[model samples]
Target: MKQLKSFIKKEFFHIFRDPRTMLILFGIPVVQLLVFGTVIKSEIKDVHIAIYDQSKDETTKEITNKLLSSGYFILDENLNNLDGIDAIFRKGKVREVIVFENNFGQTLGKEGTAKMQLIADASDPNIAKLAISYTTAIVNDYIRKLYPEMQLPMQITPEVRMYFNEEMKSAYMFVPGVMALILMLISAMMTSISITREKELGTMEILLVSPLRPVQIIVGKVLPYLLLSIANAFIIVLIGHFVFSVPVNGSFILLMLETILFILMALCLGILISTAAKNQMTAMFISMIGLMLPTILLSGFIFPIENMPVVLQYFSHIMPARYFITIVRTIMLKGTGIFFIWKETAVLIAMTLFFIAVSVRKFKIRLE
Candidate 1:
């Protein structure tokens, strides 16, 4: 009995003496709660779109003003002719466009009917659908103001046209999604567990206190996993190609480059997790429960983010997998290059830098 009590006291002392371990044990749950609380929200704000006003009338102008004022979309371009529409889409800068029919207000007043077009660049079907829904809601409010609690006898038809995936294949949606899932699992989850294993076995302290710089150690630990993740990405593409008959319509080089970028993002996230985790079990739990589920569920992989509760949709924005999935789908199905995916790529880059910076700061704080 005396020996057992002494052993338990020694164990408690060892755990409490290390501030890093104490911080990891107590700090992680709070961070996760704050992150989940702050990030999740179901709404789109300030999406970029364009307008083609053929009518250029008071009513059309008023509707346009209302759309802009609703704060869902920002006007990217205004077209006087149809010639610029294709160019605007090619630039991949705009998500949607509203085109009003000729003499829109005059026709609406005289005949109680009018026509407008909602042309959405359906490269991202989810976003396109959401933007259109918001537009429809705005148009409905306008109708209520004009007709006074009755449907307009003459319709103001909103003709919606989808640019990509007219057939809307499940493959077009799930293949990219699966790729994002696999890469995140392999890169972030596995690397985090590996790093935490060193801490469990007491080698992490040795590595940290050794000759190698902390940044170099982190990079070294993550590099092999980075390469492995890249290979796994290509393997997924090949499987998606040969097994599922998924086509690689875009440039392979661009696809691989994007894959590498996503892998780096995941690796940085892994390093961040390692800094926050005291052992392999905790790392695995954080990676699996904290990160993997979000990658699969909140990244728009299975459920359309547009359909999720508003808070969940907002939470999805912070999932690195969400942007990677969008990039993969745009490249594979839409056959677009950097011009189309640069925005998503830039987002991943920004996240990678953020994670790396945070990891470095945490390491410095611990050492100090």
Candidate 2:
């Protein structure tokens, strides 16, 4: 027991004595969290819109006000004619245009029929679809409220047109998921292998001969990797924001805390793997084959869990990455709080405990 305590102390000296190692442990996770949060979002908001109101009626004006007030659209220009509509879209400031037919109010009141055209840019299909959907709902609600007394069949009509992301760009969904997978690979797998490498190289034996315990040895070895993983998380989020234009809908602090928790869980798993591995190559192979592939294929990161075969869906339950991805997505994209994700967090905590328990048992056996 005394020898084990001495060994852990020496390991701390080795880890804290190296600044580069320390930075990597802590920095990478922060970078990855930021990158994933900012770069990878599916929701669209504040899209620019133009209005070509031929009727200039009270109903059309009211509908326009609702669209702007909904906070989903920004009115960029008012077009006098269709000739300028194409040019306005070409300038790229406006993503959608709303055109009200002439005699809109008169037709709705007298003839009980009116039509409006929603022209959208189809280049980015997801945003275009959401914008059109929102616009149509707003117009329909206005029409229904205006003529609640008169119930006429097929009286109000909205014609929706789409632009950009015509296919709804499933890429938008996958990018953030991929970011999560990458961070897990780099943070958990790499750290595990690096720590095991020291053991295989005989350095761990020297530390064990010194004045430190096994726990301190493990902590010192893991601290640098933890920092690096956090840094990587931040970078992924930044790229998601500036490059992909993904929004951080949730509290930044909450997202960070969730990320850090996942990182710690992953590191614990890495330590467990290290305890099992005989060498760096073995550690790397186990981490990659055991953790990475399951994370990519089974975690519902890229594929919807509900759509998967029941057996595979059940299999995904064993994957920690699955829960981490869920936690991150809910907090970062969906803007959910602890109340929404407590179950996932609890699962992660359990997994961390399991890994630590197993690793400690293995380490003790190895020492004996």
Candidate 3:
């Protein structure tokens, strides 16, 4: 017990004594959260829209006023003719153009309907869809108020309920992703590099010559990092909660347990990586190229898996971060319990065991 405590203390001292390690463990999580929350915005606000109101009547004017007042849109410039529509879109600042037909008010008054054209730049398909949806909703509301007495036999209005992210904040999506990313990177990369550094310095043989058993040595090395990684996980969640208004709808204790599980998984994978790599540079290269890219791209961190090709979707299934992200979003955003995330939890556990087994085999062979 005393020796293990001394080993854990030595590992912590090693980490604290290194300035780079301290920065990575203590500084990076807060920095990444601020960047994702403040800089990488998800929701559309104050989208610039252009109008070509050929009608120039009270109805069109009222509708325009309603759109601008809705706070989703800003009038970039009004068009005199449709010819300049192309030029406006070419500028790229204006996202959409609304063109109302001539005699819009008169037609609506007599026939209860007037046509309008919505031309949007499809360069950014998501923004274009959102802008169109916002404009259409405002127009429909105006029409309802204008012709309340014009009753039809049937009416169907679709009520959309945005679950998890009520405000559609990008931070809600990115925070979990960033947490997964940071935890994986710091644990796997740092551990592998640390182990490889021992090998490079020829200190690994000295440790093996000491009284500590091989398993004890490995455990001691991992203990400090495991605790540190857990602390980092809590720090990320705290910043995400208080700073970005992200909610943790599920049991907080369950969240912490899952985070610890993931950190262990990452640490085990790091051990396996250390056995494979001959030096610090090689370990770092493998960790960055192998783990970092997959975590960001294939984990559904930035893109939707369903939208990916069939082969890529199958490939993403192998990514541990993919399951972790889903689990986190479900727990934090949906407040789902373990029953809801049992499948993901099972997968993470399976992956952790697989990594630990493989690393143990490799470490034993290296010792022999």
Candidate 4:
């Protein structure tokens, strides 16, 4: 009994002494709690919307005010004409556009009914559906509150048009996200494990001392995976387009270029991870735990990022998957070209350069 107790105490001391163990035991739980608790929200908030009120009547103004004030939406633009609706949605900032027909207040007063169109950017169907529903509810609430004692039933008929994805296919949303997730995990994990395996097997020192420069060594390790990952991406896209019926409405070349950029960024990130990791297990652990969950959750893969708390939303900015998912969705669903996605493209480029710089520095330090 005494010996067993001593062994248990020694085990506890070892666990407490290892920072990684402590982090796995405690830090992960706390982070998961905070991430899950704050990130998973059924309701959408701060949804950017455009209003094209043709009537410019009192009722149209009132309904617009109600939507903007409900905390569920923010007015991104007061569009001048219906002609720009397509352009606005392609830009990806506005989620829904509310258009009130001519003489909205007058029509409601005379006929006890008015027409309003809720045209949503359904590239992200969930947000579009939620925003449309919320807008409809607010309009209904407005009619009820304004006509409590009226005998004639007043109604605002909302016609919903889900742009980009007319059928609101779930596959349309998840395919791009799944593509991002698969590429990020596979590319990053394989590259990290490959480099770390060299370190663990003591071949990294030989490579370091050999004729190859650090950049060359890194490139040599990453090149095969890069080509393989690009092939994997092509297969995924083909499957998504043919089997799942997800559209590749944009330039296929641009899509491939963006995918390559994202894959390179992910591979560079893996190299950075390898520099810090001493073994395959550690590299795998960091790749899986550090990249996977964030890619799935914070990347707006399943959950909407705007619905999350502001801090979590801001934190998601650093997640490479977030930008890639946006890029993929924009190209696949919206068919928008480089003009629409230049910012996201730039972000991925910057991340790739940053990761390469850091990984090279860290690898040199290890070589020293």
TM per model? 0.56, 0.59, 0.93, 0.61
lDDT, residue 65, candidate 3: 99
Best of the two (1, 4) by lDDT? 4
The TM-score that candidate 1 achieves is 0.56
Model 2 per-residue lDDT tens digits across residues 234-293: 876776667655567778888778788888888888888888888878888888898878
Mind giving the per-residue lDDT tens digits that candidate 1 earns over 224-267?
Answer: 66766676677668766775566888999999999999988888
Candidate 3 per-residue lDDT over residues 1-368, each given as its tens digit: 88888988888888999999899888887898788778676667899999999999999999999999999999999999989999999999999999999999999889877899999999999889989988999999889888888765597767878877877889899989999999999899889988899999998998888887778877988888898899899889999989888999999999998988898999999999999999999999999999999898999999999999999999999999998999899999999899999999999999999999999889989988
Q: How many clashing residue pairs appear in each of the predictions shown?
A: 7, 68, 0, 0
RMSD of candidate 3 to the truth, in angstroms, is: 2.0
Best by lDDT: 3
Q: Against the unseen true structure, what C-alpha lDDT does each candidate score? A: 0.77, 0.76, 0.91, 0.83
Clashes of 4: 0
Off by over 4 Å in 4: 1-152
The number of the candidate with the highest TM-score is 3
Worst 10 residues of 2 by lDDT: 162-171
- Winner of 1 and 2 under lDDT: 1
At residue 37, give the lDDT of candidate 1.
28
